[model samples]
Target: MMNNFSLLLLSLVTVTGVSATWPSDWGFGGWGFGAWAGRLSPSQERQDEVHDVEILKAVVTSMAEWERSRRDTTRVKRADGSVCYSNVGCFMGSAPFSYLGVLPAPPAEVGTSFHFFSPREPHRARSLSFEEIVVPAADALQDAVVVGPEFVPLQQDQPQQQSVRGRRDNAASDDRSTTTTSSDVAKSTTPSSTISSSSSTEQVVPSSDGSISLTASSLDGSGLLEAALNLGFNASLPTKVIVHGFGSKCSLIWVHEMKSALMAVEDCNVICVDWEPGASLPNYVKAAANTRLVGKQVALLLRKLRTQYGLDPRNVHLIGFSLGAHVAGFAGAETPGLSRITGLDPAGPLFEAQEAEARLDASDAGFVDVIHSNGANLIMGGLGSRQPMGDVDFYPNGGAEQKGCSNLLLGAVSDISFLWSSSEDDLRSLCNHRRAYKFFTDSVSPRCPFPAFPCESYEQFLEGECFNCGSQRQCGNMGYYSDRSPARGPLYLITRDNEPFCAHQFFLRVENTPSPAEPLATHGRFEVILASKELNESFVLTDKDDEVMETGDSLYRLVVAHPLMEELTSAQLVYTAYSGWISSGLSSWTVDKISVTDAFGKSMSFCKKGMILSSGVPLLVPLFPGDCNPPRAPGGLDIAMGPSISINNELPSNASGEELSASNVNRTASPAPERPTENRNKTGIDINISLHLVTTAPTSV
Candidate 1:
């Protein structure tokens, strides 16, 4: 005479072998399974409620628009150069395909190609240098589909959503193996607290003339992060992805399971994360160089998540497998607001060779966990068979007992997991280290990994091997292993959240004022910029503008292709002031003129947020990873700080309005006075962002 609840619990214990002590820090101290089972604090409670509310708000749509943002190659030539074979349906038999549509023409091979939506700007597609490449045999190709909302990675999503406030036991692991259902999660740990402020110490990603979109935020964090998520949710999807990570050389079976898991979730946005090599088409580069460059790129991407996209820093997490683990961990370390770091048996030599700051560890990353697959780690020796994989000293599982196929022929997206259950078999699951990752605290299900073993409480799960040592497929072996693949939905791409720092790298607040007739309400943070610079001989500025620049006119322009480009509401003249002018301190009101035809030039209204931008008061912030010499925090922001003008004698004009009259700004008296004995230019304007924000009203077209 057993009841449904008892029977269900019995099933859970029998199938998963979980302990009674589940859901530790999730505020559910040994409580049963239920949304309201946990006893969370006000903050935790509020966060939980907010997530649930968002879960309700999210509605799915076709993300066909976003697909255009990335380059797609339906087919590529095989090295054997035989036929144009496609990777469609079940693995088509391997036929030597010489050419594919995914790659561009020969011109694209030599010329640098630029991506409008990318913050990386003016990128040369990995390289289309047109040479011999890994020939794809028809059988080698696999049908690729984007995962929908159901596939978002919670381990990494927590940070993007601002929830990585404790040990970052991100359930990130390189566990995809022979089985279709197997997948692994990395365990991470961290103290409880969210980090939203940007650091003044970190260097901004240098501004680029190439098409680059930036993401910047401040105070409590808001901006593109919110907009993008909203946009993602609005797209054709069942759900919007909050975050995701990337791995390498995964199996087809793994991909199937991952898609299934994602399909299980409703209205979820899947944020797909991959390495540089996964840039649509395959272009090989030196493993060492690619690794380092990927790290920097990851940091820059984080800036975009914050300033351009509006993702909160504390919600950011890292999930990677093999070399991907190195990339994710290194990038997380470089980012200022990172919360969690999960290493799925990080490529040993590739990661371990670096200094502690650059490696994935508790000390370096606020929260970090590692899942050794016996697949590869220093414990055994030598980098995984995959190219660019590091030496064994770094990853412990360098030798025998490894399971994952050691082929360097898979996309990072292929490694997502379907069933994120607790079972540390082969040391892949149930390992004490793996069990404690930050995500474990949020046990969605109440039972522990060793349910069948009959552990009465959580303390036993922790103290005994039963809790930390069960695998999805195997009950014994110690290598990390994934028992299931992530179910489908959207392509879960995980980027960082909003960060106050690195505005230069990405767009922050913009003050776009198009036409005086347009209400200030139409003015928003993200507006297309129009420069008034008269294009002349070398695309440089000329004193007169009677003639438009010719095809050869040296008009080197920068375009931001990001959807969040409209967030830059505060506009500033981007010009190098004339050095010989009598108005030494004041820069001419010059800029790259934009036209109404611009994508962002359309009329749009927006709301302004309060910023401590000029708080000029400095505060202590964490240093980015690889801090050979971390920058010191300022005691306070110095609001009194002003731009460096050529002339120290006369103060610039301080105007109350957002703009200066064209007549006043269009002065041609540049040659009138010399620097030493020039006019008494005392118009007195202090170029302090703080003052301008308070005094000037919002402007827009």
Candidate 2:
């Protein structure tokens, strides 16, 4: 009876519109049988249902055949006109799979369950190492069968349903007894046979004309290649792979900012890897573990891209942060000879103590540069690694505590701040950890250059010993435009605490001449003011408590972090003595010589001609007499002593005898002529003479 019914149905389908030959475009959404058959069996409902089910089954079979055909087309013929399947191919399409460079996964038995907890919240999950979190996830990825959209957890689901907080408390104890077996670890390390044939989990993102969507149930090299081709990614141009850390996603503000910055700088392929499914937050242990697997997947995609498109690996640059930094390292290792790898404070925790194979190391790429913005001890809540992870590791502000993070944390704690807000205070807490990427983005084409002095430590850099980049000492540029030095080690530099952190750094030496009669009398704060056509800047020459400048000539090195980008003109040196038991408050000192050096190591000196300075007044000292055509002194005077300025024998004093006012001092410089075309420096450096005493009081030290 069934055979008779099937034959009748088949005959009806054949007579109606069913073609003997299938259509080439018969894919997942294509069902020409339905379109061709209009109103089939309107009088019989049961027959119609049976016919519909059978037709759907036929459509599924056709779709499978179409996939097979498409895959078969990837196999090209050899010189003999026979299809070839080699382990190593000019293109990886339909090539025989080999486990030449497959990544190792963590070990976990089937049916092992896992739970997660927030790092901020009190939880026993902390007691469980990273191995516990990632091993299970890796095992699931390598072995678990996906029946539908969702991943069937390899471990059995826990019977007791508890709140998030309760689960957090019991996570460690619940799974402590069931230790991972040795054989399970061995099996997990060696991926299952199914893994090599398995597809990756991914989503495609395009720049123009289409919304981002996941095309298939799995991610793999072929899908990635097709997506790149369809999205109009130019294989000839350099490709920048930006990978985000664990617990973060591709849509991060910094990631978008970097993409935009790179695009603005130059046209290139910017592929932002979004492994959110594997690296989801609050499950940080799981995310951390998945990094290796995701990295391997990325490597495979890159390998296919290179083989098929002839995209040079030398043009490939990997930029990753925290856990993603290690991901870049893994990819670089898997695909040898990558052009560059920039790690923005690679994650600490388990990675800190891991071997080179397990964590980011210097040998991953041709040129590996690292920025350590937050390397505070992990136990104290810091998130980045303290150990150097790249060939040239830049430590900004000692790479321990960042400039403003301390204050932000203090404010949050004092105010009982909201958990999530757009407040500046809230944003700054993450500022230090994320500043490495921010600095790099700005450096792509910054207005002001970020000049860094190479020193053994930041302390030495601050002390002014490492001011010169020449004379056997080297200098490194900070951020995206960094020029790696042959002499590699920890490079130190200081930056502003906020955005637009780049500043002009200058090292100046103040030569203080002692009073001939009372040499040991200078004991107070000394202020030096430098003026330019655009801005006025000052530095404290003498410390309030220091007595070193009392007996003889003292050489003080001052590091000026000038926020303004202007050429320096004239300077005024003032000294104020502290009121002591023996020393008078109105005592004076003599300025002999002043020398200044810039980032280029060019030194410029101005002889002060022994100008005596009183506590109540500022002593104006001329820098370049050649540029100072007609000095604008108290009486419109033009006095040039080769390279010196005359000093007033006596100065007017206020009631306190120590409060120096601009009115009390006779200070002036030659007013710059209106756009003197011929007199500008040949080098275009605006080092002209245009100084005037600022009436505003100097900030107290």
Candidate 3:
């Protein structure tokens, strides 16, 4: 009977013009079966129902053939006769045969049941019971089974039963016990698996869509807080919940790093939300749709915490990355008075132009701060939204291309491979997109304050036009301490390419003096190289256009340096002239003086009248006291050298100046020290000024 039914379905598929291979045009509401299902007449719909039944029968009789038929795609090959493995291509290729069903029933499994429903009427499902039917390994692709637990709608007036499963932790206790509720009967029949917490016997069961497991950590050093279901959550401490994005699990290294940083800074409860089952790979659209359900699950968890442990919603902070950001938004929306939600580059594809309720927005929490690291358009290979979705949106380095992500184009292509595998190495392609969380994590225990200024655009901020904190002190911090600022709009800042991205910002001004011997306007840019005891870094002071610097003109720029140098032993100037049609031999310019102001408002000026700067040559000038005179006072009298700005000062107590490498820099948050007012000798200050350009490799954490 099954063989005949399978043959009949095959004949009908041919008559209906259904290709033997998976259809490429199928999607959530795209063409193919869904479009045809909507237009079918009553009689045709009945025929479709028959086809569905026959397909189920085929599942029982010819399971191997069913799997093989989906793989057979000779009829759907492209013009080049090659299979398309792109996300859309692979998704559409396998979506048609995908079904919502269960594994075949085992013999004598009396209580085993499965849900059956047409794709067109997923919500109108019915359960089927089978006895003594031996099912083979037919669903090779795992497409027939639902990704998570089946959603059982609550019946009116019926109590909702929830089952909690626990395991025995060998180290914590020797008690071997199992607890079960009425809902265990339903859980036993489902295909969901269990994930055990590392420090406790608590088992997180993700049986249905939106289901999540939470692992709690606190500052007591016990590692786990024991509570209802052994969740071990402390109600007195502030709670921070971290949610991972698509294709990521809660066990990610960055998540743990952030958790450690949060705990090191304050005594709080850190919870990592594990939603890997619903956010699995190969079907991004499905994962995207699952976020709504996962968000509701998170809201449910929060409510449980509040009821069981008295955790205040206002004391809870949600930090989510990519799609998880929107998930946090949904959870925050459901649980009113959420204290804060920090979105680390929210996913852009389906949520870019979505309404406030659909994505992370200001109304989701009391304060919504977002860091946009890759905000370019989707077609242009940007995974993050460019739109401002939070109350205080920060666009670091313009928020599209990061300084160290040179293989952005290659990374975009590699992102497509995520449809198959979710390897950590694949993250190298998403360097810019992942930087949002890295920046946030670093800000938790920063070496220096990650200050960002209010600005209309990054261009205006880099020009040093928006350095002031304004009358309201509207400047904001970039990461963990963002709420300290009163700013309520977009903020801009610059960051380094590697670890310890936070830097001390300085506003530099170079004044050109008119030299009668060589006074022709020069089309060139000046590069300022700052030298200290530990490191030497260079930055361009002029725009990329190489704007002609006329005599007596002053150029201003905003530059950043890490491992905050307190005093400078020497400064080097490199001038590069743009090659033009006309040639001028050995072009030189005269600089009257150079001035620098640190973030603390301390200013210093180095005077060297008639200092000649030649193109393509490095000019070193002494910055120590007695080697160069200070800027003259307004009345031409020499200014007293009281509390002059110093560079190349001593390293912090935690850092070793001689052995400090980029990787070993201490990043623990600390207050900036007061500048030294004591005078220093000009001699014995070893200044190494090598024009070595440093490039940092892209890293995941």
Q: Evaluated with lDDT, which candidate comes out highest? A: 3
Where model 3 places Cα greater than 4 Å from the true spot, the runs are 1-231, 407-428, 470-473, 515-519, 523-525, 532-535, 542-549, 567-570, 576-587, 614-701
The deviation in Å at residue 70 for candidate 3 is: 25
Tell me the spans in candidate 2 whose CA falls farther than 4 Å from its real position.
1-229, 407-428, 483-487, 515-518, 542-566, 574-587, 616-618, 624-693, 697-701
Please give, for residues 472-573, the per-residue lDDT of candidate 3 as tens digits. 346778888788766678889888776556777878777776544666577877887776666677778888635678777787788877644666555677
- Given candidate 2, what's the lDDT at residue 528? 72
TM-score on alpha carbons, each prediction: 0.26, 0.58, 0.57
lDDT per residue as tens, model 2, 235-279: 787778888775555433355456544544455776666565555
- Report RMSD for candidate 3: 20.6
Q: What is the C-alpha local distance difference test score of each model?
A: 0.25, 0.49, 0.53
For each of the candidates, give the backbone clash count.
Answer: 185, 5, 10
The weakest ten consecutive residues by lDDT in model 1 span: 493-502
Clashes of 2: 5
The parts of candidate 1 lying over 4 Å away from their true place are 1-230, 233-269, 276-285, 375-701
What would the per-residue lDDT of candidate 1 be over residues 432-529, giving only the tens digit for each residue? 11111111221122111101111333234223322211222112111111111111110111111111100111111222222224322110011222
